[model samples]
Target: MYLMSKGLWGAIAGDETTSEAKEQQAHAAIVLNLSDSQLMHVIDSATAREAWGRLARFHHSHDMANRLWLKEKFASFKYAASSMSGHVMELEDLVMKMKRANCGPSEEDVCAVLLRSLPASFESLVQAFRMSVASFSFSDLVSKLIAEEVRQNEAARVEDATALYAGKRKGKQYPKKQQVRRAKGPSGTCYNCGKVGHYARDCRSGRGPREQQHDQSNVAFHASEGFASDSWVMDSGASAHMCKDRDAFEEYEEVHHARSISSAKSNVKLNVIGHGTVKLRVWTGHAWIDARLENTLHVQDLSKNLFSLTAAAARGMTVEITRNECVVKRGGTPVATGRKQGFLLYLNADYGTECHMAEDDTELWHRRLGHVSYGTLNATVKDGRIKGATMKTNVACDVCATSKQVRKSFKTSEEDAETRESSRSDVVVCSDVLGPITPASKSGFSYAVTFILMKSRYVTVYPLRKKSDVASAFERFYQDVKTTSGTKIKVLRSDNGGEYRNETMNSFCKAKFIKQEFTVPYNPEQNGMAERMNRTLVEMTRCMLKESGLDKSYWCEALMTAADIRNILPNASNKNSSPHEMVFKKVPRIDHMRVFGAQCYAHVAKEKRKKLDDSGVRCFFLGYEKDQKAYRLLNADDGSIVISRSVTFAEHSVTKASKSRDTQVFDVIEEDESVEASLTDDEDIPAPVTEEELRTPPLRAQNSSHHGPSV
Candidate 1:
C-alpha cells in the first residue's frame, strides 16, 4: 500500500511511461527500497522495467526452487521473543512473499500456521482456537491474537501490582515511586532486576523464568527480599497464615493434596507441605503472651513467615488495626501486637529457643518436662494443655527405662484395705523412712524420710543422718504442714519400723492429737502410699544422676528435685490434677522447668567478685528452690551449691567422663550392743563390695567392733 501511495508500483508492475522523468522517478523510488543484494541482481539494467523484472525474477520467481524454499521457510517460522505483534508481522511477511511467488497458503492455513508458531506458554489459548468449529480468516486470527496478548500483559501487570502491594503490607520493601520512575524506561520496570528497558520475562539477570500462565491467575508473594525465619508479618490479603519454619509448629499434619501458593514470579509456586498450630510468645508493649495460631500453612519455599488476619479472625481472635498499630486479642486478652512501618504491620513475636530446637526429639521434652511419663507428655500436648511442644517420633530413653523398671506386685494380705481415700489435705499423712541408702550424700546423710498427704498426695522428703532423726524430720514436716495449710494432721500411717514405732514418735503424735497407725510386721504394702512414694523418688534420683553424669553423693539434691517435680505432675489418685494444684488450688506453670543436671552457668553478683574475676561460674543445674524464685546449682569448680535467679543452661551438653558408675552394695554390720555403744571409728565402717565378693569365702567375725556409724 505504501509503494502504491508513493506511485512507485508502476516500476514493479512493469508500466511503461511516456515521460522519461516520471519513469526515472519510479525507478529511483524502487531502488531506494531495495537492499544491496537485491540491487546486485539488477545492477546492469538500463531501464525501470528491466531492473524491476530482474529483481523480481531473482527474489520471488515462479520456479520450483523458489516455491520449495519459501514453503520450508514459512513452515519453520517460530516465535521466541516477547512481542506478539512483531511475531505476527514476521509470519504475515512470509505469507506475502509466498503470494508473490505464486504459492501462498489459504487464510485458514495461515491462521493454523500462526497458532502453531506461538510458544508453549500459549498452548491453552492455541487449543481453544483450534477447537473452534468456525474457521478464522488470517486478519481475524491476527486481531484475536493481538487482543489476547494485550489482555495477558494487562493481567500480568495487575498481578504484579497485587503481589507488590501484598508483599509491601508484609514488610517487603520495593523501589520508591521516584526511584522507579528514574530507573524505568518508556516501556516499564522489570520485576526481576527492578531495572528499565525490558519485562521480567525478557530480563537477563532473572533468577528463573517469569512466563505468564494462560489462565491469568493472580500471583502473590509474602516477601521479595529473602527468608525471614525469626520474624512474622501480618498480611490481611492472605488466605492462610504461611510459615517457612516447619519446626515452629507445635502440632503439624502433612498435606497430601497438591496445594500451592503462587509467587510474584508467576512461574514459581510455593508448595504447601503441611498445616499445623504454631505457638508463639507474642510480645505486647509490656509483656509477652502465649498465642497459638491454628491452621497455619507450612510452605517450605515461602520467603517470609506471614500471619493472616483473616485466618486469625476465623479462629476467634479479634484484630484491631489503627493508624499505627495492630492489636490482636483472644477472649478479651491481648495476645499479639504489631507496629505499622510505612504500609506494613510487623508482629513483635518471639519464635524463642523452641524454634532453635529443630533437631530436638521427643526425649528433649521428656527431659525438660521433668521426666514425666511419655503417655502423659503426649496426652498433654495432644490435648493442647501444653504449648510449644512437638513429638515427631518416639526415641528410646535408657534412663527412663532403667529408672522406671518395677518388680511384679506381691498379693495383698487380708488385713490390708482395698482403698484409703482422704477427705481433705493434712487429714491423713503417710510417712515412711527410705534409707540406709548405700552411699552417703555429700552432706553426710544416709536416709530420707518421705511424708505424703493422703488427700493431695503432696510429698515432702527430708534427708536424715540416722534412723532416730526420722522423729526430728517428722516434727519439721508437721510444722510445715501446719504453717502452710493451717490444718491439723488427724492420722499418721507408717510401717512397723522402729523409727516410727518408738516412744519419741508416739509421744509427738499424742501431743499433736494425731493418731499413730502402724502396718503389720513385714507388710510394707499396708502403708502403700508412702512406700510407693519412696520408690518413686529413688527412681527419679537414679535417672537424674545417671543422665547428668553426677556422683551418687548428689542423690539428696536429685531426690529433692524429684519430689518437687512429682508435686507438679498429675497424680493417679488425684483425678488427673497435679498434687500442687490440689494443695495450692492453682494450675502449676511448667514453662520455667529445665532438664535436671543440665550444664549451666550461674551469674555472680558484682559485689561478690573482683573486677578481673569471671562474671559467671560454670555449674550443674540441681533443681528449683521451694520457697525462692531461684534455681539451685552446684558449682563445678568448688563443689559448692549456688542459688541464683540468673542462670543459663546448655541442656544438650553432657559430661562424657562421669556417665558410667560401677554398682556397689554395702551392709550395715553391727555387734550386739545399744545404738550409742555402736558408734565407732572411720576404719570400722564397712566398705562397698562388689557382687564377686559374695562368691568368695566368708570372713570370720572380728571380736572388736570397728565402725563410725556406717552410712
Candidate 2:
C-alpha cells in the first residue's frame, strides 16, 4: 500500500518535479497504491500551491509543502498586507476628510482604483477573512477592508442566486404559517361562582352576590272593582296600571257603564314588548285606586316605553295626565302627575279640544306641539297675541293682501316697436357733412360736421381741418358711423361743391352703391336731416363756447358733446325714445354721465403713480366716461387733451381757461399759409395763353369803318 501511495503522490506532483528525492518524498506522503497510468493522471491533475494552502485552511491544518511554502510566502504576503493596510488607513483618513468637507469620493475614482486592484474572487476571500476575524473592531481600518470585501462577495452571491432563481420555473405552494391553525386557551373565570372551570353563562348563582340585595318579588294588587284586570300586577317599568286586552276592557266598560267613562272608538294599534303589536280600544277616566304592590314598585324605575299620555286619552280624562311631572289646572286644581313608564294613556274628550302644556314637559309635548298647525288652532288674538278665548272659525289676513299686491304693468308703444324692428345688421343708412368754425383748442381743427342716419335718427359729429377736404371728411364719417352702428350706407345726400364733385367722393359712392342724392344748386333744404342736426349742433356748440368764455376754437368739442347728449335724449319725433335707444334696441346706461366742463376727480392706479404722490390730479370733466375705461379731459393749465384715470375735478374751477390762446392763433395763421402755398405752387405750373383770350382783347369796329370809306 505504501508503494502504491508513493506512486500516486509522485503522479500528483507532476512532471515538473521529476527529481528522485522529490518523487520519494511525494510517494511517502501518499497512501493508496495506484497503477502507473493512474499515478501519472494524479500527478498531471495536482492542485497549485495556493489551492493546497486554501485546502489546508479549509481543513484547519497545513500539509508539509503548504507549511514550507507559507513560511517562504509569509514575508511577501505580510508586505502586501502591510501595504494594503496602509492604503486602507489612508482611505479612511481621506473619507473622514471628505465627511468634514461634506463630500464623498467620486464613483469613478473608487471604481478605477479600489475595485480594479481587488481580486476576481476577492469577495470570497474577504468573507472567509471576516469569518476568521468576526470579533474585530469595526472602527478599525482592517475591519472596514474586510467588510467592504464581504459586501462585494454578498453582491456576487446575490447576482448568482437571482440568476439561478430567475431561470427556474415558478411553483404553486401555500405558505407554512397559513397551512395550520394555532390553538389557544379560554380567557376569563366565571364571576358569579369565582371558578375558572366554566363561563358565566353556565354558572348557577343567578347573579353576583352584590346584585341580589335589591331584588324584589313580583306581586299582584287590586286597583278597583270596576277597573279592567282588577288584580293589577307590578312591573318595575310599568307607569300607571294598565290592561289592554279586549275582553277584559269590555268587562271594565260594563262595570263602569254608569261612571260616565267613555272608551275611545279608535282601532289604535300599540306595540307590546314580547307580544308584538296588538289592536286595542282605550278607556280613560278619573278614578281612585288602592296600591298593594309597593315593595315591587320602585319610584325611580321608569321604562322608556311609557312617556307622555296620548292627546286623545289626556283630553278624555276629567283632568288630563302626562308622563312629565305636570298638572293641568282648568279651574285651579291638580289634574295629573307621574314619572314616565311603560304604556302611555290617551284620554277621551272633545275631538278637537287642546290641553295647554309647557313646551319643556316631555318629548311628546315637543312632538305634539310641533305638529299643532297654526291654521287649525282655534284661538283669537291680535298680532299673534293669545287671550283666553275660543274661536269658531279662522279669519282671512287683510294685511297680507295689502302687503303682497302685484306690481302694475307698464306697457309702451316704443318698447313694442323696438321688439318688432329688424336688427341693426339688416339696415341701410344715410348721412351728410356740416361745419367749420374756429379751430379746436385741442386738435387745432377748425370745422365740425354733422353725420345723420336716416333709418335711425343716430347722428355723430366730427371735427375737420377744411371743407375743401370734404371727401376725406365724408370717408371718416362713413367709417366711424358704420363701425359704431354696424350698418352700411345705402344712400348719401349732399350739395354740389368742387370738393363733393371730386373723383374721390364719386369713386367711393360707386364702390359702395350709395345713391348720391343732391339738392338744387345753392339749396340745402333737401338734406333736411343733416341740415337740422347741423343747426342744432352749431347752436349748442355756440352756447357752450359762449358760456365757457372760451374762443370759438372749442366749437368742435362742444359740437361732439352736444351731439352725444342729443342722440341719447328722448326726442318728440321718436315717441320719447332716444335715437340711440331706437338704433341700439336698448337705452344706453348713462349712470356714469358727468356734467360737460364740470370739475371731476379720478382715481390713480398704484402702477401709474409714485409712492409719495397724491391719489389724483385736478381736471375738468369734459364729457361722459367713454368706452368704460378712461375719462376724456381738457387739461385746463396746458390746453392739452388727455385721457386718464387719475384726476380730481373742481367743477367750479371749469371757468378757468388755459393761458395757451397763442397756440390757437398760430395754428390759424399756419393754415392760411398752407392754402396760399398750394395756390402759388399751382400758379408756378405755366399754361400757354388761349387764342380766344388774345382775340377778345383786340375786338374793334373795323368792319363798319371800311364800309363808310367805300361809299
Candidate 3:
C-alpha cells in the first residue's frame, strides 16, 4: 500500500527512469519492516517485487515442513490464560499465522476446537449451542463464550463477597449428616478466590476488606446457579439449614468456614457461601404462611434447598414424624409440613390448597392396631372408640396379607353346620388344641387349648404342658364355668383328636352330662368353630410377635392375649354386641386395652423393692390378668411375668429387639402328625382358616336351619 501511494507500481512494469527511483523507494519501504534474517535473503533482489517474493519465501514457506508445524500448533492450541478475551485473541493470532502458512483449519474445526478446549463448567452451554438451530459462526461463538466467562467470574466474585458457613453444629435432636473433608495442603484451593496456599478466610483477594473478618468455623458454603432447584427437601439427618437461592434470603451476612455437605440422594459436595434467614411460603396444614429459616446457609452447589429437622428442633420447633408425613410446629401451631416421597421427605409448597389431612394412613393404622381387619378398623373409627385413629378403605398391607394368609375353608355341613343359632339350653362349646409350637413358651408349655362358648362366642385359652394335659385343663375350665354360671355343660363339639376323644375326657363328659360330639374322621369342618379358632389365635399371635419384634417363645403369651382380644371384639353371629358383653351382660370396656406387646414401665411398690432400687421396671405388656384388674407384664430384664396395676405404656415405640437366633420369618404352624403324640387321634388335621375367612359371610354364611356359634 505504501509503494502504490508513492506511484511505485510502474517500477515492476519498467516504465521510465523515474520508475527506477520509485522501485528503490518501494524496496526500501519493504525492507524497513523486515528483520535482519529476512533482509539477508532479499538483499540481492534488483526490484521491489523480487525483494517481496524473496522475503515471503524466507518466512512463510509453503513446504511440507512449514505447513505440518503450523497445522500441529493450531490443532494443539489450548486456552490457559485467566482472561477469556485474551485467550480468544491468542487463538485468533494462531489462526492468522496458520493461514499465512496455508494450513489453517476450517471454520467448523476451529469452533469445535474452541468449545472442546473449555473447562467442564461450560459443557452444558456448549451442548446447548451445539443443539441449537442457529448457524455456526466463529466470531459469534467466541463472543458468547467470552460473555459466559464474564458472567461466571462476576457471579464468583459476588458469591465470594458473601460469607460462607460450613460444617454442621452438633445438636441434641438429630444425627448430623457426614461432612466430607477436603484434603488440606498447598494443593488445597482457596474456596474464596480459587487461589492456592491460603484458605478462603485468609485470601486477600476474596471479599475485599470483609475477608479479614471471616468466621473461623470449618463450615463451607457454595451455591451453583446451574444446579439449584426450587423445592426444599426435609432432611432429618441434616444439622444445619441450606438453600441455593440468594434471593430467598430475607437477611444476609458473610461468614468464613469450609466443609462439604452432601444429600442422601447424591454425594456431590455443596459449597456454602453465606448465612441468612430464608423466608419460604410454607403450607402449615391450614394455610400458606411465610416461615423464616434462621441461620440458613446459601449453598449454590446444592440441587435443592434443605430444611433441617435438627436445626428446626434446636430453634424450639417441635417435629412429629410419622411413617407418611413430618409435621413441624411452634407452640403447638403447625408452621410447616412435609410429605414422604420415596425415602425423602419434601416440604409441600402448595399443601394448604392441595394436601388433604384426612386420616392416618390405613397401613400405619393397621400396624398400630395390631394388624386388625379393615372391618374392625372401620368399626373402631366409626364408633370413635380410638382417638386419632382412622381407616381408609382399599389400602393393601403386605404384612397383613402375608401373616394372615390362610387356606380356603372346607364346605360346611348341611344339617350340623359350623355356625348355628344357639340359646342358654344349647350350652354348646367348641374346643381345639394348638401346638407343639417350636421354641416352646417361656413357661415351658408347648401346647394350648381354647374353649369357645357357642352362643356368646366368648373365648378362653389354657396353656398346657402336653397333649394329655388337655383333659385336665378342660376339667378346670368346666369347674370354673359351672361355678361362675349355673349353665350346665350340654354339647362339647371338637375334632376327633386323642386330646379331646380320649377315655379321660369321655369319662368326665359322661359324668357332667356333656355329650361329646366329635367330627367325622378327618372332617374338621364339622367342628369348624374350634378349627377356625386355633388358626385365628395362631395368626394373630404370629402378627403380634412379628410386629412387636418379640421372640417366638412369647407365642403362648400372644395366644392368650389374642383370645382375650377376640372375646372383646364383635362377633359375626351377634351383630350388636361383643362376646364379652353377651357373656357378661355388660358393655365391654376397651379403653384399658393397650397394644399386646407394647413397651411399658411397671411401677415397683416400696414393699417389693428396696429404697435404693428403681421404682419402675422396664417391661413389655402381655395381657390383662384374668382374675384381677392388674396387667400381665413381662420383665424386660428377667423374662419373668409381672402383674402390676400401675403401668405406663409406650405403644408407639415398637423396637426391633428380635434376637438373631430367632427366625425372622414366621412360618405357618403345620400340625406335626409325624411326631409321636404319646397317643394318636384317628383324625386328619384340616387346612386352617383365618379369622377373616370365618367372619366373611360368603364363606360361612348363616345356615337356614339355625345360626351356630360365631367362629
Candidate 4:
C-alpha cells in the first residue's frame, strides 16, 4: 500500500502492466500476514499502506503491547542483592524497549526509575543525595548504588563478627513454673477433675500454686525526681541491671512482642531496644579495674542506671559493702569497687576530657541521654561521653522532634572551638531579635530580643516594642551584667541586621569599649548564641502552649518562663553549675515553682470580694513575676491576669482525657499574601478580651479587671 501510494503500484506488482487493484491486493496480503498483536498496533490506521508503516515504526509490528509490558516492568521493578546490577540493567532494557516503541522516557525519568528500584536501606542514601544535590547522572547514581552495596556487605561482615564474639550465650532453660511437679495418678489421669492426660496442671480442685500471667502495659516517660544520665547506681531494690541509655549498649535488639518488667504497683512493658555489655571501669583504693556488665536491660522510661546486687550475684560475682564502699569480687579477688554515696554507691568513669559520643552512634547516644542536650543531664544521669568523638553532625532523633529545644544550642566541633578561641562570657554578648510572633503577646509586644553571655550561656529575653528597641534592651542587659560581674564587655556579636549595626548600637559599644563582631551580611550561624537561644525559646513557647492547651496570645508568659528555666538548666561550662549559679553565685530557687499552665486557685483578697463570695478565683499559672514574690496567674473566670503569692495548685488534675489537644494548632500563624498586614495586625490576635484567658483574645486579656493583693 505504501508502494502503491508512491506510484510504485505497477513496479511493485513485478510488471509495468500491473493495475492499482493488484498493488492494493499485495498490501492487504502483507497486513493480513501480521500477528494479532502487531495488527492492534496499527488498528487505527486508515489504509493498508498506513497500517503497514505504523506497525513497522512504533512497536516494530507489535510495539503497543511491548510498550505496555515494558512500562509495567519499569513500574514494578524492585531491588534484589543477588541481582542489583541486573535490576538496573532491566530498567535500562525497558528504556531501550520503549525507545524502539517510540515512547522512551526522558533522561531524568530514567535516573529516577533506577533509584526507585533500590532497596529500603538505600532510602537514606537517596535522600542525602537529593538533599545536597551536587550532581545527578545515571552513571553517578549507579556508582553510588554499587558503592552502597559494597559498604553494606562490609557492615554485614562486621555485624557477623560482633554477633559471634560479643553476643551473649543463651542460658539454660528451666521447667515452666506452670508445669506440675508430678502426675497425680500412675495412670496419668487426674481424679480431681476426672480428665484424662491432664493430671495436675489444669485441675482446678488440685492443691497447687497457680502462676498468674503478667500483663505488660506501655508507660509514658516522666521526669524522675532523682536520676543520673551515664553513671550507674548500686541498688538492692532494682530487679535487674536496668539502663535507660540506649547508647550504653555495645549491641542492641529491638523488641517486637510485648515484654515487661514488673513492680509492686504496675508492670511496664519492655521497649527492649537491644542489650550488650557496658565496659565498667571502677577505681579501687589502689587502681582502676575493668569489668563487663552483660545482659543489661536497655529499657525506656527509666531515669537512673541501676546495678542490681542480685544480678551480679547470679553472674558469679560477689558484692561486699564494707567501710562505706561496695566491692565486687570474682573468685575471691576484687574486680570492681565503688565509693558509697548516701544509700547508693557511685563509680565515676575515666571517659577522659574529650568528645564522648562516637561519630556513628550519635543518634543512639542522643536517645540514651534522654533526648536532652549533651551537657544538660540532671544529678542522677552520668556523663557517658566517651573519648574520641569524631564530629558527627545533624543526626536526627524521633524522640527529640518535640523534646529538643535546647539541643540545637550545643556547638558543633568547629563552632565550639571557634567560640572558645574567639569569645569569652560577659566579655562578649550575642543578641538577636526573634520575631514579630503572630498573635502578639499579652504585653502587646510582637518581637523578642535575646541576649546571651558567651561565657556562661546565660540568657536574658526582653519583649520588644519594635526592632529598634533592641539597642535599649542591650543597654539594660549590659548594665545589669556589668554591675553584677564587674567585668566590662569586650565584644558584641550579631548579624548585620539594622538593629545591631545602628548608630545607637555603635555608640553604646564604642563607649563600652566593646568590639562589635558583625557576622558577614546574611549569616546568622556566626551569631549562633542569639539565634539558637531565640529559636529554643520560641520552640519551648510553642511546646508549652500546645501542652497547656492555651491559645498563642500567652507566648509572652511562655517565653519568660522558658527564659527562667534556661537560666536554671546546667551550663556546659561548669560541673553541676547552672547559669544562675555561675552568674549569681547561688542555686536558683526552684521550690517556689509551680507547674507552668497548671490549673490553680489564686486567693481573692477579702477587700476585693465579699466574704460570702468565692475566696479563690480559678486561674491558669502564667509564670512568675520578675523580681516579685508572686505568681502571674490568668483568671479563668474573668480572663484578668493577677499577681498573687497565695495559690493552691491542682497539678495532677490535668490528665490526657480532660485536655483536648489541637495538634495542628502548632505554628498557628496562617500564611497570607497581604503586604505586612498579615504580620502586624493579623487575625491571629483573638482581639476582643474574653472570660477565658487561655482562649483566643491576645493583648486585651491580661488588661482585664483583677483582684488586688491583700493589703
lDDT of 2 by residue, 1-711 (tens): 332434434444356655666555444343112222223334432343323333334444334654554333322221121123223333443443443334544534433334334433354544554467444332332434433432332232211011101111123222233322211113446544666666444556555452422212111111111112212222111212333221111111112111111111111112221111211212122542211111111111111111112211223332332332223233444343332112212222111112221222222111111111122222112112222234433333232222222233233345444532332222433344443444444566655444556545666554556666667666765665567555677767666656677889899889877777675664453443454454345434444444344555555555555655555444434534546676666654322333455555454445657977654455565553333234667655566666764343333223535433332221222111111110111111101000110112110111100000000
True-structure RMSD for candidate 4:
34.0
Q: Give the TM-score of candidate 1.
A: 0.47
TM-score of each: 0.47, 0.32, 0.44, 0.39
Residues 308-374 of candidate 1 have per-residue lDDT tens digits of 6655655677777665677888897777899754334678876433212333445666786556566
Off by over 4 Å in 4: 1-377, 380-416, 419-422, 655-711
Could you tell me which residue pairs clash in candidate 1? 680-707, 681-707, 684-706, 684-707
Model 2 TM-score is 0.32
Candidate 4 residue-wise lDDT, 1-711, digit = tens = 335455645533357576767656655555544433355666566545566566557745345777788778767766432323334544665676778777788888877777777655567787887686476776667656644543443332211111101111123222233432332453567644556776544555533232223323222212221223345665433324666654455555655544454321223233454456665556655687655677777664454565655456556777666546677778998776766443335554443323333345444333322233433433212433233233443455433355433321232566556655467666877777777777786667777777777666677677766889889777876776677666577878877878887999899889888898887654555664555455456555665666666767777777777666556556444456656666666655433444567787676766778757876687888876654456888888677888876566555344221246554333422122111210111001101101112222111101111111100
Local distance difference test scores for all models? 0.60, 0.36, 0.59, 0.53
Considering TM-score, where higher is better, how would the candidates rank from best to worst? 1, 3, 4, 2
- Tens digits of per-residue lDDT for model 3, 1-711: 445566776665456665556778877667554433355677778878888777666667677887888778777877553334435545666676688877878989888888877665577788998899989687668656644643443333221221112322322212122322222333667654676776554545634432333222221211222111456767543456777655356577755656445432213344566788875677888897767788888765455676766566657777776656779999999999987543345786631211111244345445544566666656655655444456666567665676766444434344444234432232787788877777776768777777777776676677667889878877876875676565567888887788887899989999989888887775555555666666666667777787777887777667766765666556445556766666566655454566777888787866777867886798988776654556888899988889876566655456554554233434435453322211112211111211210112101111111110100
Q: In model 2, which range of ten residues has the least summed lDDT?
A: 702-711
The regions of model 3 sitting more than 4 angstroms off are: 1-369, 410-419, 422-426, 608-613, 661-711
- Give lDDT for model 2: 0.36
What local lDDT does model 1 show for residue 83?
A: 44
Tell me model 4's lDDT, rounded to 2 decimals: 0.53
Query: Candidate 3 local accuracy as lDDT?
Result: 0.59
Candidate 4: count of backbone clashes, pairs at least 3 residues apart or interchain: 17
